[model samples]
Target: MSLLRQLWIMVITITLLAFAGSFAVSMLTARNYLEQQLYVQSADNAAALALSMSQQSKDDATAQLMVTALFDSGHFELVRYTDVAGRVVVERANHAMPEGVPVWFMRLFPIHVGAGQAEVSDGWHQAGRVTVLAHSRYAYLSLWAGAFRLLIWILAAGLLAGIVMQLLFRWVRRPIVQMVDQAEAISERRFITITEPRVIELRQVVRAMNTMVARVKTMFAEQAARIEALRSEANRDPLTQLANRNFFMGRLAQALENEEFAPSGCLLLLRIRDLAGINRRLGRERADQFLQFVAGKLASLSADRHDWLLARLNGADFGLLAPGLSADEAPAFARELLENLAELRRIEITDESDLGTFGIAAYRHGDALSTVLTRADQALAQAEETSNAVVLLSDSDTQATLVAHDWHTLLTGALTGEDFLVASFPVLDRNDRLLHRELMLRLCQPDGRLLTAGAFMPHASRLGLMPVLDLETVRLGLVELGRVSYPLAINLSSTSIADSGFVDRLVSLLRQHRDQAGRLWFEVNEFGFRDELRALAAFGERVRPYGCKIGIEHFGRHFGSIPQLYDLQLDYLKIDGSFIQGIDEHPGNQQLIKAIVGIAEGNDMLTIAEGVHDDGEWLVLAELGVQGWTGPAATGRLQG
Candidate 1:
């Protein structure tokens, strides 16, 4: 039962117990008092009767009648007159007894008491002694009636107390219910703050809930800020204040996919008329400023309906992807942007106002970035020769360009068909022994061409297909493992690492091949680990059994994260190639390598240097406390 129900039940139980106890005490007291009063009344009546009989004549029937009448009307049990020698007696009796109370109540607490007695005699000389027995019928009646009345009073009092208690409980529980409703709302992800309650205890609960809500709001705000930072870093160009190449390419691809009018729209490439000369005359910083000014003007001229996107492709090169715009409309937008740039340049460069020269080239759908850029370069050259502020290619390039292939189709085909393959890379030990061979997955076409991760991973990720590929790769690795006894390592995708089912499968695989588990290694990228370290660590602990080993690949550059290394039971750390490429000369690189070694050593983990192609870097690393090394220097197989 709930707490409130239990408490109310306890209250009722205690109240009933108290009522029973009071009833018992009252019955005992009332019975005893009645017995005492009856005894005194009998004694007084007997004495008075004896004195009156002595004063009258011996055969006085009047006195006898008076006493008999009183005894009969007073509900007496028995009245009697005895002679001096006690040989004969005069007796008076009442009718048979009547039950006044329930038999169960009477049996449960029987009211048994001795009857009151009295002696009747003539005064001064013993005439006849009158002995009387007080009746129990009147006492039983009185006791029964009193008990019934007390029960009714007790019932009324108990009812009133329960009603008052319920009212008080309702008042007290109001704020508690409000707090509960607020908590329920929060559980449903609908945040609500409750007003402070009058009850001190309930007010504390509300305070805690309010604090929790505040914390959640702060956490949400921080998460939003983090997402915004990531977005800005992904899209914004720090230097030109325009979108970067990645953002522009993403939008361009999206535009191509929108088949209605976006895929058939114009793409434009804009360039400074004479960027090198401008840099030579005004210095590099000032030239960059000029480029920013041109970008600003282009941004202002583009209409929102056209969905124009501007990006800095490189130094002095800008791209405009305008979805739903024709090649003719592109030149108009370019002309307006150039005019704004010209006006701004005239105001800034008062001495050589003609330096505001620029070029624009536009192409309708199917024109590659390279082709458009070439046309824009040609236009810029022509503008330089003619000494004009702006120029566009008048002739449309009617020749067919290479069609941008749908990468999603290729990914889907590769994932569904038998196009994906796994390749092995050796991760050697310190003595150039094959400690483990890492399996790297590659996608190959039916045309005998191999595709690297760069060719399909981004598309696979965009299509939410990494987990499938990772699972397939793992199955293939297990298949290949059945063929060999060498130590094998399989790389896990970020999505796979976060999946609980994948973790379970990995553990199950190891458990199935318990003897081979010591030879099996699981690898994850440093980037993936950083994203979900806690989850990965928990996964690591879950799979630590069955003798499997876990290691991180591309593990360097995030030196501040070394503290977490102590918590994770990683078997090895693969230092990134950047630090190992030229470790002897760079002092910073040397210190970093040593620090990583120290961190791993302190945590009882082995450190491996990747890309150690030469003996010198290898020797340096060995001296710096690296226990394992894997690079081109190590042979594919362990030499016995």
Candidate 2:
């Protein structure tokens, strides 16, 4: 039971016990007083009547009359007049009993009193003894009345006392409840402290709890500082602070799947005009400022639509996915965004301040991502011909995009048809030594044409077939691990990690391939990592005995859940490609990368660079304490 309940019970018990004790004593006292009064009345009446009889004549008639008169008074239970010679002259007795009082009550508390006896006298001579017994029925009525009133009063007092005590205890123990809540919050990764209570003992406990919360907050601050750099490096474009390609694409993919954001949605593509030439004429700093300016305008345009997905796709390209807007509304949205970008001329730039062009594509729910992008690209190309106008593209072939349950059918067939293939990319260490092979997934169409994961994984995810697809990849990866002597790294999707059945199958697979377990490593993206780290950790524990490594890709994309990362059994973190694309010149990225490297070093974890394409980026990564690298640079090293 809770402390409050237990205390209340104890209090009630004590209150009842005290009332019972007091009530018992009062009842006995009242019963004793009534018995004494009854005895005194009997004795006094007998003595007085004896004296009165003595003053009367001693004749039989007179004595009988006197006895009859005394008995008729009803004050005495019995009255008797007898001769002094021990002869019965006149005798009278009463057979009266106390009434209205329970027999059990009288039996439980029997009242004992001495009966009255006195001798009568006749002119200085002893005549006969006179005895009297007073009635006790009135005493029984008084006792019953007093007991009923006493019980009612005592019960009322007990109920009132109990209620008052319950409220008082709850108030006094309020601090304890707050302490419990604080502890629960801490367990949930939220550090909340409570104010000290007035009670001395409770105040001390609250102080201790508050002290612990403060310490945890400080620890979280130090850890968050580390994740903050990684988060910014991954989630945002370095120059614009807008969502990067991968994050935006994830959101866009989600929007495409949901009817709330599809069927009546539009995709707007903004391509900066003459970005390369502008960089040459206005210098690198001015060119970046112009891009930042353009990004700011795009940010403002989508600010009101919190669900809108906006991203810096590449150097001169940006994409926005806005749902809940009709196809006819696309022109208005594009015009507003284009006009906002045209504000570049207001920034005192030379030459043509044409800003950028807008490309819009509208599609229904379940439209393939490729079709949307293709339409948007075509519109963008057409818009480029018109200088600064917006271009809209309508799908020429609606049958091209798979909708309804088509993706499920396709994914299931692909799994069973053995149309899935695994491709390995090299992960090179700082010394250019091969650390592992990152396995990439590919699905082939019935026409025998190969398709990259970028082509169909979105559909697979939307259809909730990622577990099947991901498991197939792991299965193929295990086979590949046996075929090769090196470890193979595989990516896991959020859906797979969230599925208990998938975890079970994965555990069974790892156990079956115990000999090759060390050769297989699993990776989850930032989205997957954030979505189901606990599940991942549980799975990790289940597979840890098999000697496997689990890491996160695109580690810096989101860090709001970084506090939970401490609980996750992650082996390494791969910095996102956005930060790696041009690391050498981007001083901001270099500094953030350095901080991330420090965090990794402190945690005894490895840090790897993704999408390293040049020696400049490689050198910068080497200087930033990055241990491994992948992408074109690693591929080139492997080829060499």
Residue 108, candidate 1: Cα error in Å is 3.5
TM for candidate 1 is 0.51
The superposed Cα distance between candidate 2 and the true structure at residue 174, in angstroms, equals 7.0
Across 152-188, the per-residue lDDT of candidate 2 in tens digits comes to 8777877887788788888886887888888776664
Off by over 4 Å in 2: 1-9, 51-129, 135-178, 192-348, 351-442, 448-450, 458-553, 558-640
Pairs of residues clashing in candidate 1: 77-135, 120-129, 120-130
TM per prediction:
0.51, 0.51
Candidate 2: lDDT of 46?
81
Question: What shift in Å separates residue 373 of candidate 2 from its native position after superposition?
Answer: 23
**Prediction 1 global C-alpha lDDT:** 0.66
Listed per candidate, the RMSD to the true structure in angstroms reads 12.4, 11.5
* Cα deviation of 214, candidate 1, in Å: 5.4
lDDT of 1 by residue, 1-640 (tens): 9656765776677678877888899998998898877777666666666666666666647546756876877667767776667744456777455476676765655544344434444554556776556676677778889888888878777777777777778888888888888777665444567788788887898899999977866654554344344434544677776777655654554344322123345556665656788778888787777777777777777734424678887776677776545555555666666666668666784224554344666554446546665766777666566543456663564222222256667766777787888877676766776677777677787688876553455456667777777777777777777888887887777678898887787777767766666666787877678777877778777877766778887674232223255446688888766467556655555666676676566456778887565678788888888877765555433432
